[model samples]
Target chain A: MEWLQNFLPLTFDRAVVWIGVLCTIAIYSLLYRENPFYRFFEHMYIGLAAGYSLGPLGVDILYRYWIEPIWVQGYWAWAFVVPFGLYLYFIYSERYGWVSRLVIGLLIGASAGLFFQEFSSRYLVQLNSTLQRPLWFSASNPDLTVGNLIQNYIFLAILLTVMTYFTFSYQQKGTVKGIATAGRWFLMIGLGAIFGNTVMARMALLIGRAYYILSDWLLIRVGG
Target chain B: MQPQTIWQKMLAVDRRLLYVLLLVNIVMFLLVPVRMPASISPPVQKFYDTIEALQPGDLVMISSNWSASTLAENQPQLEAVIKHLMRKKARFSIISIEAQSRDISYRLAERVTKAEGYEYGRDWVHFGFVPNLTVAIKGMVTDLPNTIKQDVRGTRVSQIEMLKGVNSLRQYKLVIDVTPSGTVPIWISYSPKEVNIIYCPTSVMAAEAYTYLDSGQIKGMVTGAKGAQEYEQLLGIVGLASRFTNAISFSHVLIITFILLGNVAMFMNRLAERREA
Candidate 1:
């Protein structure tokens, strides 16, 4: 018993790392073949993630916004906010499903209101930037060099072609079709670039796991 | 059945073998002591310059909204950004929309700050997790104190020594959204126009952000671990990104090789079938 105890992690931090190692190995086991170890850890991870969220939700959100205001701050009006939100669950009740719409309507109305600002803030800035690009270098825009001028021309060309591709007003024929095809090719190239970045990101994640195993568990110095 | 051709055998290779090869490649490269130099992209350089321009004690809001799922990409980005901020002697406050991020970022920042002798309340603070980004940004824009009533430690935001006079997001010098999510749009939509916004998006999210970068909506960007590596080069310190650079770069080469090998095998298999026909 003493020997077994000595072999086990005696400290809390060490125990945590031990569990982390076990979980990591169990999760990665699925790469070889589906097995019970992977399934067990997978389910445990989902359950733990959901349960862990409640801790922060209670302390940071529910307690701070809902409970504290009603109980401590005497903002009694804030008390009904949760129950009003819970009205959304009425959708499950055949008789009271209409009650759910009240919450849904509030959400829709709020989202619609938010969209006004969102559209103006998000898209308008980009539009302004597109329109503001100087196609040719000038004295007034001395900072816009030969490289920037060429970039702006390429950007505008792609922008128009892509927009033209999505134009559903009429059937694209001859030159319009040719431009649209070019747009499609450009989009494919963009998507390829994105996929390339995705591969890089996935590799980084694998490297991270390997680093953990080497540096944390095996006590090997990684990356010198 | 007749003996299978080499091309057919290559085509029928188990996917598990590919995974093992990738794992081996990453592990081998991770152990390699050689540090590769990164070519700094314009966006990464701009990201560095934005922080370097920050005067001492200038307030910045860090929207750290990434969890352990994106730890490999976002962790190094956040670490490098935090180190840069601390170097500039900036007083920053972090807000997390992701629940796990609140704890992860807070713990990470604490560990980083501890080594640098950075004080918690006066020098930096974590406002903890807020459920919604859109509503939170709008609230912080109008009333920072009332919106974020308390820090993660339960101290009132108004009573915090550093935030005594800060009541609106407009007062902050900069907003840095360190995320793997699309929450930057909300910040762009609602944040004070005076404050410069920057981004640290995971590589997958980086492609879509170019339009914003072009628009100058975000003053700068750091796109994932590779970007972080370039940033570390600029900062002249060997951090996690610097350490992980060799592995990530080499892994890309490995994947490209795999792709080319698969394509060649397929082409050769097709040509053999044509000859047999």
Candidate 2:
């Protein structure tokens, strides 16, 4: 028990980590063989996560939509939640599934309404930004400044080529064909880069896990 | 016996040998543990400079969205950023979108901040975890206290010491996201223009963020372990990130070299095949 606080001078986070490391190994053990240990931890994790989320999520709903405005700000009546409560019971049977449509409809409508508005600003803006030539005004010959210009051009080429390769148009002819082929090659290169980086990231994660198994669990107990 | 045959021999070298070479390279670098000060990229420098410019009593929002598995990259970045914020006496609040991050980042921040005399509720608060970053951001933008009603300790946000004045997200000067995920765009879109967004994405996430860095959407970025190493140098502390980057940088050089040799071998093998035909 004294050892649980062993992370203080160095980390001060032993309690959760002690449990989490064992859980991680349990989860990963499925790769070798399925056992009661993995399921026990897995279910416990899911249950804990569900329980943990309920309070904050409940607060978000109550504080945002109901309590603050009605009680503190003095905006509306408490009776407004009556219909909302009815909306939750539509799962009783197939016949009443349409009862829940009111809730689903609003959600879908909001999502659909905001889709293009949000996409245009976030994604389209990013797309437009990526299209700029790195050469602020063309670097001195091919020798180039080799800085933002190189960075910008690489981003633009990667984005454009990756987009083109995903285009499913079958009009394969001339420059379109050439562009498509180039796009395919560029996409392959991009994927290769992602794969390489992914390997490094995964290796880093593995190293962290190993440190936990060796240094954290064995050498010293953790603290929270 | 022929030049073509020699090329074929080189081309047919066992891939496991390359793997062994890499393992040796990484192991050797790890043992030496050189904290080579990186040539700070513009984005990383900007990230450092942003923290350097913070004034006392300034409020910042930190979204800690990474777990322990990302400790090699995200943990160091967060530590460095938190150190800066605390050094400047900038009161900050942390929120996590991931469940583990809430515990991991919050506890880690609490640990780091305590040494700096950062009193909970006064100088630093943890808002716990929330799913749906987009919806949460919108809510926080609209009503900060209501959206994040409780501190990680379960105290109301309004009751929290430093957060009493923070009615909405507009009050914060900066939103520094120390994450492996690319959630900066959400903050960029929803938050008020007054709030500057800095990023701390893992190396894989950093390349994509260069576009944002170029566009100035994100103030700057700390890329992976290398960025953390550069940050550690700036902080004058030797941490895990500095240690890991030795392995990473040498690995990068190794990969680049392999790519070059692979191309050369491919060309030679093509010549050999043609000659045989």
Candidate 3:
């Protein structure tokens, strides 16, 4: 038994790598066909992900923010925060469901209050930027060259047409319909660009898995 | 049934066969000894310049909110950014809203920083996972020490020598958001206006962020692994981004080739059907 153990010689790190390799193969096996092995790993992955989050939530959030403050720092008022948050679970109880709305109302109020600032900082800044762009070159805008001026004009045209496409208050007729059609074309092109980027993103994910297999598992020397 | 034409047969090829082809293409390119340098995009160049401008000991905040699902895209970006920060001798702290991201970024930063002889708590720190980004941002803006409370190591934020004078988000020179979510708007909304924000978004999120870039809300961006490759080129380092570049580039080419072929086959098959009619 001792001789066999010595000969095999599996370290903790190598075992981890082996398990990772197994999991990867199991997950990717679904590409061939749906099977029990794939479903088992898929379920295991979801369970592990959920369980993994609890560790951080406990250590980083509950311990640091809730428990430690009350116990160590003597911020006793902090103790109620979690219980209050947990009140949301009361929504499952028919008789006590009214208790849940108290938490819901708090959340909605906070979000609405935050949105006021979000609106000004987010959309207002963009609006200001759109209005500020120079359509043509001028001495005052010395930094803005002919190329930038042309680009700015194109941006303005796209912005207006896209907004026109979204306008549903009035009936479309003649020139308005023509502009809306053009807007739809522009939107299609924009969505196409986004879809192309999405493909690149998905491909990067696959390449990442390949890198892990070759570099980490197979012990091959990929580029730095 | 009528005998199928070559185009019709091509159109009927199994989907699994295409998946195998892509897998082969990626592995082949990944193992190729040859490396191609990427042309630097304007956003990546700006991202570099922003870090280059950082003075030694200038504090920076990193919002790393991506999990293993986006490891290929976000990992390279995070690593390149960390290396650049170390080179600039900047002090930085990482925060994550995604629970899984907290551990991944923390461990990745630990490995990278250790290699560079960057001391934890002194040169860099991790704030761990926050459940809510908006509340966390608002709290940090008001009172950083009280909000974050402690580092991942259990050291109080105020006790960390590197963060001695840092009591609010306003003190940080810059904020780098490495995420695959729309968390950037929250940062743009609530973070101190004085601190400049740069973004590293997965390719899918990159399109929506262009408006922010145009508005100068974000100083710059690094879009997924392709952008990371460009950044690695700018940094003159051959990190994971460099390794993955060939695979990503060639895979795109393969996809385009197959798309064109499929379209042609469909067109020819339609013509044949019309003739039969």
Q: Which ten residues in a row have the lowest lDDT in candidate 3 chain B?
A: B1-10
Q: Is the docking of candidate 1 incorrect, acceptable, medium or high quality?
A: high
CA lDDT of A69 in candidate 2?
68
- Candidate 1: stretches off by over 4 Å: A1-8, B1-3
- Sliding window of 10 residues with minimal summed lDDT for model 1 chain A: A1-10
Off by over 4 Å in 2: A1-92, A127-170, A217-224, B1-34, B249-277
What is candidate 3's CA lDDT for residue A102?
100
Q: Which candidate is the best by lDDT?
A: 3
For each candidate, the alpha-carbon lDDT, in order, equals 0.91, 0.75, 0.93
Which model, 1 or 2, shows the larger TM-score? 1
Q: What is the lDDT of residue B32 in candidate 2?
A: 63
lDDT by residue (tens digit), candidate 2, B183-267:
9877877677778899998867876776677777788888777787788777877666766666677776887788898889889
List, residue by residue over B74-94, the lDDT tens digit for candidate 1.
999999889999999999999
Best by DockQ: 1
DockQ of 2: 0.20
Error of 1 at A19 (Å): 1.3
Give each model's clash number.
0, 6, 0
Better of 2 and 3 by DockQ: 3
